[model samples]
Target chain A: MAERKVTVTSEVGLHARPAATFVQTAAKAPFDVMIAKVDGPPVNAKSILAVLSLDVEQGDFIVVSAEGEGADELLDQLVEIVSAP
Target chain B: MGQVPTAPPPTLTGTGVSPGIGYGPARVLVLDVPEPEAGARHDGDARAERERAEWALEQVAADLEARGARVGGEAEQVLHAQAMMARDPELATRTGELIDRGVAAPRAVFAAFGTYRGLLAAAGGYLGERVADLDDVRDRVIALLTGRPLPGAAEFAAAGSGMGVTTPFVLVARDLAPADTALLSPDAVAAFVTEQGGPTSHTAILARSLGVPAVVGCTGATAIPPGVPLLVDGAGGSVRLSPPAHEVARARRVARAGRAVLPAVSSTQVSGSHLFRRGMTADGHAVPLLANIGGPRDVESALAYGAEGVGLFRTEFLFLGRAAAPSVAEQAEAYRAVFEAFPGDRVVVRTLDAGADKPLAFLPPSGVEPNPALGERGLRLLRRHRDVMNVQLAALAAAATKTSAKAQVMAPMVATAEEAEWFALACRTAGLASPGIMIEVPAAALRAADLIGAVDFLSIGTNDLTQYALAADRQVGSVAGLQDPWHPAVLDLVAATASAASGAGKGCGVCGEAAADPVLACVFVGMGVTSLSMAAPALPAVRAALIRHALAQCAAAASAARSARSAVDARAAAEAALSRT
Candidate 1:
C-alpha cells in the first residue's frame, strides 16, 4: 500500500472546487483509494459524499492510501491537489 | 388560464422589499417532494429493485450535469458538485444493500442519504450549509424514482432558454431555496411573490439584486394556482389576483414611468430631471443620500446611484469564511480601494460585527449561551479580543491616510455609554479622526444623549433595532410582520436617537432597509436624520420622493406616522400626510 499525509492548504479547505477535483481524480484511478483525517476512520476517496462528510478544514492533516499498480502516482497527484495554494 | 374567477379577485398584502410594478401570469413553484414510507418493501426480485435505484441516481446525476452545461460559470461549478454527490459510489453501494434487504428503491435511497445527512449536520459550519445541497440531490433521485416533477425543474428549464419564458410570469412560492433560484434571470421572471420571508431573507436579497419587483410574506401566495393573471406592486406590497384589464394597464404605465426615471450611468449633468444627483427636499433641506455597501466591489453601483458617500462599509467581508483574521496590510488595501472610489467624501467603516449568526472561526465566544444575539457580539466580542479590534482600527487609519476620502469608523451592537466611550477612545488612539457607534440596541437609543457625548455621531441600524426591540428574530419568516421598521415603537426609538444627535449637533444617519422605502426616507429626513443610506437600486425613487416634498411636509408625515398604533396604520397615515401638498 502507498500512503501519504498532506495538510489541506486551500483557503476553503478540502471542499467546494477542491473536493470536486479530488473526487473526480480519485474516481478515474484504477485502484481503490481511501482517505481520512489523522484520527478518523478511512472512507472511499472516490465518494464525494464520504469525503465531504469528513469535513477536513484548512490546515487539518489528512492521510491518503491506495494499493495497486499505480498507487504511488495516484497518491502524489492527490497530495499535489490538496497542498496547492 | 384558470377559468376567469366569478368573484372579484382578492388583494394580498406582504412586505415590499424591492420596489417596482409587474403584471404577469402566476407560476407557482411546487416543492412537495414526498418522502417514501418507512416500511415500503420491494418485490421478491431484489436485482430489479436495485437496478431501478441505481438508474434513478444516474438519471438525476445526468440531469444535473446537463443543467450545469447549459449555464456555464460559477453556477455550473456548484451544479457539477451536486451531480458528484448524486453519483457518490458509497451512496449507491449503501442503497443497493438496503434494497437487497427488501426495502423499496425510494426508501433505500432515503435511508442511505439520511445516514450521511446526520454526519454532515454534526460537522457544522461550512459543511453544515452543505446539508441542504446533499438533501437536494437525495430529493431529486427520489423524485425521479417516484415519477414526480422535480422541484424547480420547470423554473430551471424556463431560465435555460436565453431570454426566459415566452411570456413573462410572476413566480409564487412558499419560499425560494438557493437551488430553486440558481438559474433565475431578471428578464425571464417578471416578479416574485413568496408566502414566507422577511425583508432580509434570501428571496428579498435575490429580488433586489435582480432588480425584479418582489412581495414576500404574502399570506396566500402559494395557494394561487399557476397561470392566473396577477398584478404585483412591489413598493405598495400588494398582489392582486385576476385584476381587471384597466388595473393591469395602469400598473404597466407606472412601471414604464419608473424605468424611465433611472439615472443614466454616464451623465454628469445635474438638472431638474436628473434629481437623483443630490438628496434634498422641495424647500431645500440638504439630507445627503449614501449607499450601504458590503465592500469595494459595490463602489461603482453606489456612484452610479449618485451616492454622496458610503454610509455603512461592512468590514466583516474581510474576516468571514476564513480560518484567521486577514493581515493588517491586506485589510488596509481592501479598505483603501473603497475610500479611493469616493475621494473627498466620508466613508463610514463599521468594525467587525462577528458573533451570533456570523461567528468567526478564529474568534469563538467564551462559552455557548442559549441566546447568541444577546451574547458576546460586535463590541462585546472585540473587547475580549482586543488584538483583533486593534488590527482592524490600524488598517482603517492606514487606509484613510493613503486616500483623500474621509474615513469615519464605528462599532456595532454597542449598548451602553461606557461601551461607546471605549470604542471612541480606541479609534482616537489608532489615529482615526472620527468615531461613532450604531444605535442598534434599545438601551443605546433610550440613553442616546449620554451615548452621543461619547461618540462623534450616531447611525441607526433599524434592522437590528427592530429585531431587539420587538423580540423578533429578523430571519424568522413567521414573525416577519413584526420586523417592520415603521412600527410606532421602532419609529419612536429612531426619533429618540435622531433628536439626541440633533441636540448635540452631531450628524445622525440611517443605514437600514427603512431608509430604502421612499415614504420612510422622507419621514426619516423629517425626523432630523441628516443622511439616508440604502441599496443603490433604491436611490432613484427615494430621491424623487424627497424632491417632491418639503421638509415641513416630511416633518408632518413623521409626526403623523409616530401617532399611529400599528406599522400598517403608521404607513397609511404617513402617505396621507405626505400627499396633502
Candidate 2:
C-alpha cells in the first residue's frame, strides 16, 4: 500500500465542504482509498460521512493510504487537496 | 378513510394555530416507521441481499436529488448533502458486511446506520445535528424494503416529480416529525391538518413561520381520504371536505382581500416587513419582544422578526439524542454561534432541560418513576449531575467573552429558593454575570419572591406551569384540554411571578406558548412582566396586538381576566374588555 501524510490546511477543516470534495474525488478513482487521523484507523475515503466523522481540523495531520494500480497518483491528488490552504 | 361527497360537506373543527385560507387536494404524511423485527436473517444469498440494500439506497438517493432540484436554495444544498449521506460508501460497505454475516437487509441497514448515528451524535455539535438527517435516510431505505410509504413520501413525490399528485395539496398527518418538516416546500403545501398538536407544537410553530394555514388537534384528521380536495379555513379552525366551488371561491376571495390589506403577509413570505418596529405598547411602555430559539440556525428568523433579544435559548440541542454530554469546547462553540448572532443583545440560555418529554439516554435517574414528568427533570437532573451543570455554565461564560451579547444563564424546573440560589451561585462560580431561574413549577411561581431574591431574573415557562398547575400531562392528548394557560389558576401564578419580580426590582419575562398569544401578550405586560419571548413568527401578530391596545387597556384586561371564574371566562373577559376599549 502506498501511503502519504498531509496536514489539513482548510480553515473549516477536513469536514463539511472539504470532506465532500475529498470524498467526491476519492470515489472517482478505480483503486480503493482510505483516510485516517494521524495514528488512527483509516476509514473509507470515498465515504463523505466517514471522512467527516474523522473530525479532522486544520493543522491536524491525516494519513492517506491506498493499494493497487495508480495508487501513487491517487495519494498525490488526495494529499494535495488535504494540504491546500 | 373514504371520501364522503355529501351535498354539504361536514365542517370539522379544530384549534387554528396559524391564520390563512387554503384549498387543495389532501396529501397524507406517514411518519412512523415500524421497527424491523430483531434477529431476522437474510436468505443465504449475500449477493441478493446486497442488491436489495443497494436498490433501496439508490431509490432514496434519487428521491432526495429530485426534491433538492425542486426546492432550489439553501434547502436544496441541505438536501444534496443528505443525498450524499444516502449514498455513503461506508454505510453501504457496513450493510454488505452485516449481510455477509447473515443479517437481513433491513436489519443490516439499521445496524449500519446505527454505527454512524452514534459516532455523529457523540461528536456533539454541527455533526451532532446531522444525526437526525441520517435517521431520515435510514428510515426511507427501510420503508422502501418494507413496501411502506416513506415518511414524507407524499410531499416529496408531489414536489419532486410530475408523476405524483402534481397539484399543491393540503398536508394531513397524525403529527409531523422534524425530519418530515425539515425541508418541506412551502409552495407545495396548501395547509396543515394534524390529528394531535397544540398551539405550541412544532407543527403549529413551523406552519405559522412558513405562513402556511394550519389546524391542529383535529380529531379524526388522519382518517381524511388522500387526494380529496378540501377547503381549509385557518382562522376559523375548520376543514370542509369536498366543499362546493362557490364556497371555495368565497374563501379564496376573502383571503385575497386580507392579503391586499397586509401585502407583506403571504403563504411564502417570512420577513416581518412593515411590522418591523421596536417592541412597545400603544402607550410606549417598553416591553422588549424577544425570540425563543433552539439553536443558532433559528437566529436568522429571530433577527428577521426584529427580536430585541433572545429570551430563551434552549441548550437541549447540544444534549438531546447524544450518547454523552458535549465537551466544553463543543458547548462553547455552539453557544458562541448563538451569542455572535445578537451582539450587545440579551441571550438568556437555559441549562439542559432534559427528562420526561425529552430524556437524554446518557442521563439516567435512579430507576424510572412511573411518571417521568414528575420525576427527575430540569434542575433536579442537573442538581443530581452537578458536573453537567458546571460544564454548561463554563461554556456559556466562555462564549459570552467572544461576543458582546449579554448572556444570561438560567436553570429550568427550579421549585425552591434553595435550587434557585444554587443555580445562581453555580453561574457566578462559572463567571457568568446574570443568573436566573425558570418559573415552571407552581411552587416556584407561588414562591417567586423568594426565588427572585435568590436570582437575578425570572422567566416564566407557561407551558409546563400550566401542566403542573392543572395536573395535566402536556403530552397526553386526553388532558390537552386541561393544559390551558388562559386558566385563571395559571394566570394567578403568572401574576404572582410578575409581581414578585417587580417587587424585587428585577426583570421578568414570559417565554412560552402563552406569551405567543397576541391578546395574552398584552395581559402579561399588564401583569408587570417586563418582556415577552416566543416563536419568531408569533412576534408580528403579538406586536400588532400590543400596538392596538393602550397600557391602561391592557392593565384593565389583565385585572378583569384575573377576576374571571374560569379559563374560558378569563379569555372572554379579556377579549370583551379590549373590544370595549
TM-score of 2: 0.66
Tell me the docking grade of candidate 2: acceptable
lDDT of 2 by residue, B1-581 (tens): 22432343377788888888988998776555766767999879999999999999999999888887876644555677788988998899999999999999999998999998898888764576578778888899999998876877547546434345556789998887543465465677889998887776768766765667999888877666677888998778999998999999999999788755432432113245443456777777888889988777678878877788899997876774344578899999999999988888899999998877666645667564689889999999988889888888889888998899998998999999998888888889899878998999999999898888878999999999999999988666678789889999999999999999999999999998789898899999989999999888678777777776788999999999999989899999999988875
TM-score of each: 0.77, 0.66
On DockQ, the leading prediction is 1
Candidate 2 per-residue lDDT, tens place, A1-27, comes to 999987889765775566777898899
Q: What level of docking quality does candidate 1 show?
A: medium
Interface RMSD of 1: 2.7
Query: What TM-score should be assigned to candidate 1?
Result: 0.77
Give lDDT tens digits, candidate 1, residues B1-581.
11322443488899887888878898877665678889999986899999999899999889888887877655567678889988999999999999999999999999999999999889776676678778888888888898865766557557545445688889988887543563566677888999888897767866775667999989767667778988899888999999999998888898788677554321222364655477888887888888887777678778977888999888776775344578899999999999999999989999999888667756767775569889999999999989999999999999899899989999999999999999999999999979999999999999999999988999999889999999998768878778889999999999999999999999999998789899999999999999998887888778878878999999999999999999999999999999996
* Model 2 Cα shift for residue B136 (angstroms): 10
Q: Please give fnat for model 1.
A: 0.87
In order, the candidates keep a fraction of the true contacts of 0.87, 0.61
